[model samples]
Target: MGVKITGIGSYIPSEIAKNEHFGKHHFYNEDGTRFGHENDVIIEKFKAITGISERRYLPKTLVTSDIASFAAENALKNASLNKEELDYIIVAHNYGDVNYDSVQSDTVPSIATRVKHNLKIEKPTCVAYDVLFGCPGWIEGMIQANAFIKSGIAKKCLVIGAESLSRVVDPHDRDSMIYSDGAGAAIVEKSSEEGGILSHYSATFAFEEAHFIYFGESNNLELKDTRRYIKMYGRKIYEFALSNVPDAMKTCLDQSGISVDEVKMIFIHQANEKMDEAIVNRFYKLYDRTPPKDSMPMSIDKLGNSSVATIPTLYDLVLNNELKGYSVKENDVVIFASVGAGMNINAIVYRI
Candidate 1:
């Protein structure tokens, strides 16, 4: 049986924050070259660089589950399915709601339990689990879901990618400017059709790149404050993307028996506008094609990088008819690719 995406949903926090408003905060320096001097300059830069003007954020009262729940409910509604029908739920997140009781284990079951109770899913026998792989988490989730269905362990599954990067943002650092809070959900079920997840490929360069982008604790006593924030060697990370993502895409396409030219769209992780351009340029040079114009659209300017939520949010935009000249059709091949912390890169082919 083929695995197919039955529904899609996305949630951006309700509080909309513009660059101008962000600039007013004292932590934002007017002469900071990282983001530019003036609010207008920064906003213009964000628009020119990332194609994003504004993004939403959750209120203090809301958590990652709140955002995921909204998206999950909407996904089920869009799919015309009940929550009780899901045999499994996978919550892909790097950061979850801070709960005293739920600190040590996977947060998916907790989030799933909330969803089940909210929907009154009395007989839901869903196995809920969490996956953390930076921006590649959703692709990993898709692969795992396919395995579950193939193994007859699950017939219907809900995969979600939700994050609240705002909580982890270091206000003093300009690097954190692009991050925001958001979530995306998808309903996947067994199908007889040809379109779905076709091939998955991923690789990690473990040596020098390990320090390029990291978010966990550090061994240095003097760097204790760094543990609480996300850190990145931006130039190094960019170089890694330039070298690795295209190659991963090529491998994924090869495994799927499809050439690069056959791909209608390339959905690279919405990491940054510059990184996206670098990947698109490499793809064009390698394939002699124009890199599918508008293929690497950015939500970073508005939403920052929502980690795993990037691809699903982009998918949601497509499903809502927000993306121009893009529509999913049977047999159409789409490439989902990402490079993030852990210095990891992944490419997966999907037939929509």
Candidate 2:
């Protein structure tokens, strides 16, 4: 038996937070020192580096689980599968659900359970859970689903990556502008078809990188509050990703027995444009070739970094032909890769 994504979907929030929107906000250094450059200059530099001009923000009335369910419903429809037949529901995220007006996150009932509840699935055997492996959580969830299906524990699984990073960001931190909110999901199931998940790799480098991405107080220390928000060492993450991610992708592709020349596309996490390009370039260099034009389709320009939601969402967009100039056909080989908190990294070599 092989594991394949039979269907996919994504929820791109209607509300757009343009870079221009941050113009009025005060950005400060980690030490709470005001930036020497004005907000315009900072935003311009940010756009140049991250390639994010605007990002989607979840509406105030909805929560992470809500969007996750939306994406799940769409995927179910796309697959033409009955919801009651699903054997597992996996939701990947970092923060649970943070209200628009509050910093507290709600995680009592797992997001998967909430999604199952939202879908009104009554099957008691449809086990639901959540994975918090940082931005790679979604791909990790897919790996687990593949394992379950291969082991005869499941026939079908709904794996979702959803996050409201906007709800967890510190306005005082410039990195806050890099975050957004969104959800993406896929229906993975057993298939008799020839091509499916061929190989995968995962690693956690927590020895010294454990806290590279963590929660910390606002950059504006003048507030004097204990509430923490999403924080990270940007330079550290960039260097770490460049040094490690390409090797991980190469390892995954090699395990699949697919040569570098056969890869049609690579759905990498939409963390930063420059960082992603660097990783792909390094991966190609591993085989003594440069990356092919249009090999990487990026949504980061408009979606920002929505934590776990990036890859699946981008895949969904490309599949739907909403992402121009990128398309995948039957029997195509592709790679899915991501790096994030836990200082974790993972890659999946898949055949379409």
Q: Which numbered prediction scores highest in lDDT against the true structure? A: 2
Model 2 lDDT per residue over 1-352, tens place: 5789999999999999999999999989999899899999999999999999999999999999999999999999999999999999999999998888886999979999999999999999999999999999999999999999999999999999999999989999999999999999999999998888999999999999999999999999899777899999999999999999999999999988999999999999999999999999999999999998899999999999998999999999998899999999889899999999999999999998
TM-score of 2: 0.99
Model 2 root-mean-square deviation: 0.6
Worst 10 residues of 1 by lDDT: 26-35
Question: Which 10 consecutive residues of model 2 have the lowest summed lDDT?
Answer: 95-104
**Alpha-carbon TM-score of each model against the true structure:** 0.86, 0.99
After superposing candidate 2, which stretches have Cα over 4 Å from the reference? none
lDDT of 1: 0.75
Per-residue lDDT of candidate 1, residues 200-239 (tens digit): 8988787888768666332222334433556677778878
Identify the runs in model 1 with alpha carbons over 4 angstroms from their true place.
25-52, 99-120, 216-227
lDDT of candidate 1 at residue 181, scale 0 to 100: 81
Q: Pairs clashing in candidate 2? A: none
What do the candidate models score in CA lDDT, each in turn? 0.75, 0.95
Residue 228 in model 2: lDDT: 91
